[model samples]
Target: FFAGNGNFYTFVVTATTNGVVNINIPAGVAIDYQGNLNTASNQLSRTFGNEYPVYTSSNSGGTISPVSASVGQGLTTSFTVVPYSGYTMTVSGCGGSLVGNTYTTGAIVAICTVTATFTQIATAVLPTVTTGAATSINMNFATGNGNITNIGNQVNSKRGIVYDTSSHALPGNVAPASSSYPNKVEEIGSFNTGAFTENITGLTSNTTYYMRAYSYNSVGYSYGGEVSFTTNIYPTVTLSGYRIFSNINTLNVGTALEAQNTAHVFSNSGDSFRLRFLLHIANSNLSVNGGVFKIQYSLRSGTCDTSFTGESYTDITSDTPVAFYRNFFSNDQVLLTTNANDPTHNSDTVVPQTYVEKNNFSNAIATVPMGQDAEWDVSLFDKSVMDSTSYCVRIIKSDGSLLSGYTVIPEFTTATYKSRGGGGGSMYIENIATPGGTTTGGGSGSGSGSYLTKCSDGIDNDGDNKIDALDPECHAGGTLQGAYVPSNDSETVAPALPTGGCTQNCGGGGGGGDLGYWIRTVYGIFGSQFLRNSMMGSVIVSFR
Candidate 1:
């Protein structure tokens, strides 16, 4: 024993008995204590089987995995605790302290308590769903707003998005399952203090989705408030046929038609020069209101203004894709018989037969939906090219956006063949003439003259609307049915029908004969090539 006043002190006591011992020190024996030594009178002894510094360990709120510890003198025993899900651990009570999740006992001879106190885990705050796109979406989340405040035992954290056709609430056990891509919830790994975003793909197009962001911790998931979005949809389109008009279509009227086969384009000024197409609309359900019917010309025998840079359509596997909308003109277009009585023929009814057409010619649009036909018309503002260029048509979206691939081409043409009597569907003078008629039309080229097929111009030549061929007075005895030769020409006796065709062949001298028979001989002289050049005015036609 050592005291603060360092005086020499010594004690020696021989054992009276081996198993037990008793010691008695007088009251004045220790001055520091100022009393007798009580411990010298009594004693306790240990004779157990395991005696050299025995050690033990334990914990609460969690499990110490290897609780059965070694009891060795100066030997360290390692102990680990297994926390239940959200539970954590703490070591105390005598033996050892915990480093991380492990507890190593100190050099000791006593048992100790390793307490593992478990509490709920706090996950991140609910996430925010930012945007939704075709087949994918963007979601975000953050920490610090979770339900579980126990940050000490946060084993792990993750962020991600959850979505479905319907609503999904927080703390839910079930989530949406899509047959589409990314069939499950997307989870981003743990992050601190910053934003988190995850883009999930394979979402369906044009579908509305309910979505939210989510955070997870050792405890459970915390969700962001609900959000939703829908994708955009584009409709399909298709076209069928178109109608032509030389004049305004009367309003509220059913089916106003103009030239179907042979539409005219006279090269002279102050002549009828108007035409517009009313295309039949189909698939109105897909009316994106983003399309137009554009027509480009391919001119020939007909004359055009010099500055005209004719359009050329290319790139198709077969024929080039020209701007031909609706049904096209075919060879079936015969010479249009100028019949003033024809309901479809309006050039005759239009006042001031010499009045020039300078206005755009088109009709009111009709509703074109599926299972029903409607009209989308194009006003042919420029007419010089139509006289020769053939047409071709195709379907294109209003925005000119692609559908699958190439534009589908339909049958189309603008070649006006000569009809039997200038019939409604007959070709304009461009591709027609009576076998021996002195007029050639169409790509065959044209001939200029007032020397029309005198009998078929459909004009009341002598000041009457009752045209020739049909008017009884126009039969032979009327004013000259031949080309109107200026009255100043000398009168010549009408010659007999010589041999075959020529009854009146002028020999360069200014003379007049039966103009009807004069033109027949003109037919024999010029043939078909000379016939195509005929560009007479105030044309009319009869319809079936």
Candidate 2:
């Protein structure tokens, strides 16, 4: 039978046994309006059966458990999708539902195909971090800072600064604990981001160190840029040199007393001595400017000895020690003058005025320079009430608070001079001139005679070229008036003169007549007895 419409045809066939089926259309069976005939077609046949064909397919990323299958008509079939590692899969072509890795089609009315696909999965990456600069660096410690800009795909397990004396670069794809870095500070329970700080201690002084900020995650460790810093050095103060002046005049004359032990003597109960110190300061750590220098003394009752034992004595505190010279400047240098009271008169006699009278001198503190040796003069003692007592002195430095880490070259010991009663005596002189032509005697006698003492006589008894008050051994109480006569014939030994020539008058005395006028004028202008005396000598030579 055939039923047809315009260019359409239908055929029906029925089978009764379960067997294979083939279908084909023969040529010339149909024709178009143009009268074109179709080619011959093969025969067609079919065997009715209960099963229908099921097909399956997949993309490159995955595979199907079953390539193909057959099911009864109006029944369902399924295919398992197996995706490779780091990949995913999906199915299409057949109307299907997926559960887990399995793809199942709806009831198969005829043959249909199911497809599977796979895609690669993404992997987590390492975190990102940066190191900040070091701060508050000191001799033994410093502060380090860092920041974590990104936490990446995983939470940071730890974050902090890592430091070492030598630098260590962060390795890629390596965990912080497995890295070669020697030291690290991990902030426990700090898995978040942002800035952080750690205090690094036990560092060596004057040493350079490198540091970095780090963060750790499941992927690996991340480190910030590297930073480096150096610790500060400690400061030091050292005593370079020291000298003793027998009296104020010796100090003014730039003479240093070298005798030690009992050989160094203070003849009178009212005599005072001076101690000069040279200090060398180094390093910028100490606050030397506007700092205080102190001289501490211990007094004991006994004969002066190298070892002071068994004699208990009291420390002197009535008079504070001060610099002998005035006008101490910024560099710790002093303007040394022969005469402190009268600046106009040039003389070798030097004495520091009382601290209360000089506004320029610091009563309780002294200013010293850094990185050099500074000269300091301190009035040690006055023997007025210190009979049969021995004393020793040491120095200390301070800046608001006391300073340490200093060494004195030669440790201080007990005093070399022992004070004894009746060491003072008076002498009589025949005549003394008072800057005028008139002559007077100590006992109301008027004739000049050989009875003049060595200190007051017009002759140079020691042949050291210095006469009377001009000689340091004269000990005329820093004046040329011929007062304070010596008790014995043995003259007090004066220390060797310093390298520089006298800056002020080397001798003290009154003047008279035209010579006196010349002396006064020259002394007033030059402030140097050496200059006045030299000019006078030149005048005398010209006259001769």
Candidate 3:
């Protein structure tokens, strides 16, 4: 039985005979839109526009017709009253109905007609859930007479549920955010677009989840359909630093410097560059030394702006105990001159050598030493130079014969050593004394010093009777290497003489420590060798 007309109750009809249809409405009962009872009316009804009717009829010696009713229409509605049996009642607000009549023992009998209503339950639609995506679904309801309200609790409870199973609406309600880079839950938005989303983060690489949506209205809670999705896979690679090398074994200074410049100039050169990888590592410090380092770099098919050359060398192996960083070392480099006979080149063309494949610094820095002549000579490429057609300077290896990295500076051009002054070449010697020291300068050339010598006379000045160039003991060579003087070798009154040779022996030296007598001797060597008795002694020497 079901409620009808707010107070009327209708009984479900069962077939009595093969051709007889029975309609039974219980007295004083009504059916609400749902299965609940509505007691306001003892009559139940519905109206059909132009499509309501008992189109087909099965009769066991009976006749049937339609009927109607309305609200507050009080009538003792029973299951046996029929219109064909002369039972009539007027009730307003009622719609389609049915009436039936039968004849029994030559007497007419009528059966009452009953109406039944069907209503639908409300429901929601759920969207598919992904491991790293925003999710949402809609909530909806179905009721015969529109009696649902307040749909908040159901949707909010399961708003973020992103996983599901047969028994559970979502096996994993809480999932990682959509962006693992930022790694956090983000409440994006919840509009009428049929979903409420909260971004999840920190998800494992490859995983899956199931999800469903739920909603609540004034009527009841409703649920949406379930969905599932999977995440993608990624590689597990750990990237550190890079290393470069030239000439194979020794730490290539230019290669290491280029790797450093790649970071600053190129910006896209990852963290490191390498060649002939001696050791590849990370997390440790690195350094370079021991060669004339020249950094040659161009702006990707453009012009190169600067060059470098190492002067002094230092060894900077890892300071830390651990060798976690890469190490690169290369042999020293030698520059080739085009004017001279070629060593590393054939005719005038410089052949390229083996590719450098490692980074010299574990930290990716080109450590240039101090006082190095670090500059680049730009090649002026006027149309006139192209017309003349020449080559540039080339770089050679330490063996005076080995071929190595690129050499394009001094090959076919006359710009070699122009930017750097040489010939009476600029000597860069280390550990030389500071300026004005006893050791004036340190270089490849020899040095000079000052000394003193005795003057000679025609007389037996020292009583040895030696005179002029003929004196064996006094005159041996033309000039003295270094010596001290004594006025005892000459009797000459002194006037300060300009520096020059003595008349007799320019090579001979005298015992020193005589001040006045030495002054007299120098005066006599350059002027008159005649000194009074007051000036006669040895001399002390000093260097200027």
Clashes of each: 44, 17, 71
lDDT of 2 at 168: 76
Off by over 4 Å in 3: 1-184, 188-190, 195-202, 209-228, 233-440, 444-544
What are the TM-scores, per candidate, against the unseen true structure? Answer: 0.23, 0.27, 0.18
Candidate 1 lDDT: 0.34
Question: Which structure is stronger by TM-score: 2 or 3?
Answer: 2
Top lDDT model: 2
Model 3, span 412-452: residue lDDT tens: 11111111101121222111123222211112222221222
Candidate 2, TM-score vs. the true structure? 0.27
The 10-residue segment with the lowest total lDDT in model 2:
506-515
Question: In model 3, which range of ten residues has the least summed lDDT?
Answer: 138-147
Ranking by lDDT: 2, 1, 3
